[model samples]
Target: MIDYRRIGALLAGRREGYCLPQGLYNDVDVFDFDMDAIYGTGWLMAGFTCELPTPGSYVSQMFGKWPVLIVRDKQGVIRAFHNSCRHRGSMICKPGSGSAPRIMCPYHSWTYEHDGKLLAAPRMGDDFDKSAHGLRPLRIEFAAGAMFISFAENPPPFADFAEKLEIYLGPQRMDRAKLAFESTISEYANWKLVMENGRECYHCATGHPELARTFPVTMSKHFDRANDARAKEFVDTMTANHLETEAIEGDWWQLARFGLNRGAETLSMDGHHMVRKLMCEENQGYVGSMRLAIDPHCFLHATSDHVFMFSAVPVSPTETLVTGKWYVHADAVEGEDYTVEGLSELWTRTNLQDKELAENNQLGVNSPGYLPGPYSRDAEMLALRFTDWYCNTARAYLAGRTAMDAPIHVD
Candidate 1:
């Protein structure tokens, strides 16, 4: 039996004693995951359940090291396929997203049914068994209205992942949602840099100006802002001083059942105040977003009237293509002149700041003397949780463990 208690103790000790050199930023070896790291196992969010609204509706993309296509069969089941045609090696679906009665290979024109059964190969003789040439199906499961696909045959059910997350994000908002807007970006920094920056609010006043203003960034004031310039204008107009949720570890953050893991810099230091809106529910309403990064690429964020989500699709060690999806009351998104610009702008500024910092951070880490400093216990406890997760999970995976040990809290 694996001794989890011992492993937990080992991880706890490792966290306190460890110091990561800046070189990790430039280490492409770790950033480029092994074939097993991505395709060998585990669940990855492929799309939203609502996205595939009809049978034969299909979307294709390269997920991790694997090229994948997903479709909803007439049976109302959402299924995933390898997306490669069996004969002559060709891609089956050409569009990023679409609706089709069946998948047709662009190269040889091999047709596949929505269920992935080989329908017909024109040039092939009748002697060729169609059953042997069907599309390779991938393991897929759905939960919390989200869709996920896995290469592992016996991976944990999708419900399990949802259950684990529900503990952090209350059930109310988790179930109700509607699509709003989305965007994508290719960055020159490793995916980890983006993720780590998003998890902590310590840099808000400095890195993200527009963000620091609109969001409840500082649990304190007179603490020089992260971007002292941006936070300046909205500082006073913040009509109702941010009404923080119950204090968890003296951090002035309200635990919203979820959050983003991609990194960001706070536009610390108040600047110009923009139009301020009141969303007061007894003076405590939706201030901004509560974001969480769930493992690889998936980000969940909730704001007052809607939620903005992001996914970081890792393309290379220094490049990541991102995708954003906005959801609001189904009715709220349309039936009027609506633009996703205001929402996209916030993320745009946030991303631009992170790009500047992370690229520099990447260069800095290249210095042999560079070292990542420790997080303050109170202000950065959440970020620490990730450090623990990263170190321990990587070690366990490298050690040939089939399952990750549950997190053991540090004193």
Candidate 2:
């Protein structure tokens, strides 16, 4: 068994406003703990609702080590289940995604309904109980146009999260959108490092020329003091844009909208919209990018014309699989409404830049001379918030407390 006390001590020793200890990032024990305490228990954004537009449509992939199958049942409800068969312990579905009237096990040919009920077993004992052997169901939550799942017996209060999410994503009508493009990249780095790289843009000026054209370099430092006239001007512009967006949407801008720099409107190479058709309902001018965070594993960016959802899946102690999905209007036609290459080009290059950054970060942290470094007082607030949540959540788990029941803290 893993040593809970030792792990608790490791978590307790984490210093605030600084990077994580080298051991926490490189040790096998800590990685396993993270998988259970964070990813397994938290409400992680798995996929969008549009992926399963019709009944019997399904998508299967490994979310951590658990092979999960997300399917739309005959009731028009999306449900998740472990992809393994109950009788012989074999994968019921293949590795990729497709549509099927029923789930069938290749090994024993056991057929199951889309709702995960065992429909037929070729030859079992005369007294076999099919009702008792249905596929194990998992906890799933839906909000806006996204679907989230949890592996823990008791997950955090998702209804509360969804209530807030609607205020941010409701106008966009994400459930009405469809997937236009998707890409996956395997990075040779720790999962924490990948998350850390995502939460800050301190390297954007030098590392990401294409993204820098649209994204402000000082975005992560929300409350920091402005150092120059240009910096002050950026802050003023962002504030004005945010207030305007809130006025139009009729809701308080909690953490939804963020202003970009260089006079760019969207995340294109030229800082403009890639498609003419808009995704959100409001036809007002481009206010800013709608940014939302679900904590620990998911971040979303919605623009006037499109939306991009990014997620990281831990593969091992030293590797992570990062996935990005691009969304547009359901009726948007290719070539006429939007080009896949145009919608995907900006983020594809940005993701590659981030992959290299994470790989090098892992290499440095793995060295014997490595030590935790202080975070910048100006920037890196989100990174600090992430580390704080991670340590506190791990502590709660060690004390046998569910995430929902733990003490709440946010900046």
Candidate 3:
């Protein structure tokens, strides 16, 4: 049985600016709690609209324990479904991307139309009501060409998030972008550790030399940015160029634009354009990077030449699936404009390095002597923010569960 009281105590006792307790990182019960309270309730970036470019296109994946299907219907409207057939709860779509005129359950041949209306059931009696047996639908929304979904009946407000996304990502024209390359790496680490490693660049200088070539490692230090003349000048230059320079933050999301290292246009090994076709309207390169991060699951970085989408998904108590997708202009040709190797090299190398680091961290955290450690205030502010958000959200969830489970007496 899961220990909800222990989980609540751990969350309530978490120290500010320190890493989470060891149990929070390696406990199976905590993992289940996170899947229910965090992943189950929040909006997650499932797939891009470009992945569903045409009518009948679809992508299916397991969001925690929920089998989610995102599809573009015959009317070209993107939709999300629970991905389960109503008859026996068997999954209707296989994992991965494909184009299908209708969703068919391989187990029982229960079929559904593109919009999730039940079409046929081979063995069911004529009295069966197909209309009431349609696949279950989930809440879905779109912003800046990216698809977001929620399993919650009443999801958190999205208007503010969508408005901020448009301000930061609209100029990139992600709707006109196409997936150039994609990869998923299994990291033997806690999902929080995977995200914490990504939220800070304290390891970038020595750990990710390839990424450090184009990305400024020092720019991650929030305290240093205030007094750094170069950082201010970079923002000034970006503003003078009429680009979006605002840094917007909310409870569960952040949107900001930052300049890359000198002479770097996009996150390439050589600090040059990886694709011939630009993503935005900028005539020249060096448009900098626009970053958007939604807590717990999604991170995006868009440059003038291309865009990168990342998601850290929990597979178990100590395992995470890190998926990365590289996107370029829709018209970009493989050999002439960009090669898959060129478009994905920098991030691929960086992701592999991070996987090793996170796995090692997990191993150490699993040790008996493990204890939470303090974060560097300057370099690890974002990491600290992530932990704070986790604790607060988990506390709220546990409180609500307690209230719901409490017995009632006759009044």
- Pairs of residues clashing in candidate 3: none
lDDT of 2 by residue, 1-411 (tens): 555555766776677888888877877887788888888777778878898989899988778777888999888989999889988879888766788999999998999999889989889977899988899998988887788888888887666667767766776777778899988899899888998888788788898998888887765464333455654564466455432222111111124465566567677889877877788535353556777766677777888788988888888888899899899888888999889999999889999999999999999999989888987765776677777777777777777733534432221
Where model 3 places Cα greater than 4 Å from the true spot, the runs are: 222-224, 406-411
Rank candidates, lDDT, best first. 3, 2, 1
**Candidate 1 accuracy as lDDT:** 0.56
lDDT of 1 by residue, 1-411 (tens): 434344434444443533343433444555544235433456677757666767888878776446889998999888998878899777777637879877889887889989989998897997989999899999887655667787777764455546544433332243445455666666677666666666667787777766666555554321234354433433332323442222122111113321111122111123211112211222133233444455545666554455566666566666666676765544443424235664456766687787777677666666666666777664555556555555555455555543454553422
lDDT (10s digit) by residue, model 3, range 230-309: 66887787777777766778998988887788888888999989899898755376677888888888888899999998
What is the TM-score of each predicted model, taking all chains together?
Answer: 0.72, 0.89, 0.96
lDDT of 3: 0.86
- In candidate 1, stretches whose alpha carbon ends up further than 4 angstroms from where it belongs are 1-24, 38-40, 156-158, 164-178, 219-255, 258-290, 333-337, 401-411
Give RMSD to native, each candidate: 8.5, 4.7, 2.7
Which window of 10 residues has the lowest lDDT sum in candidate 3?
A: 402-411
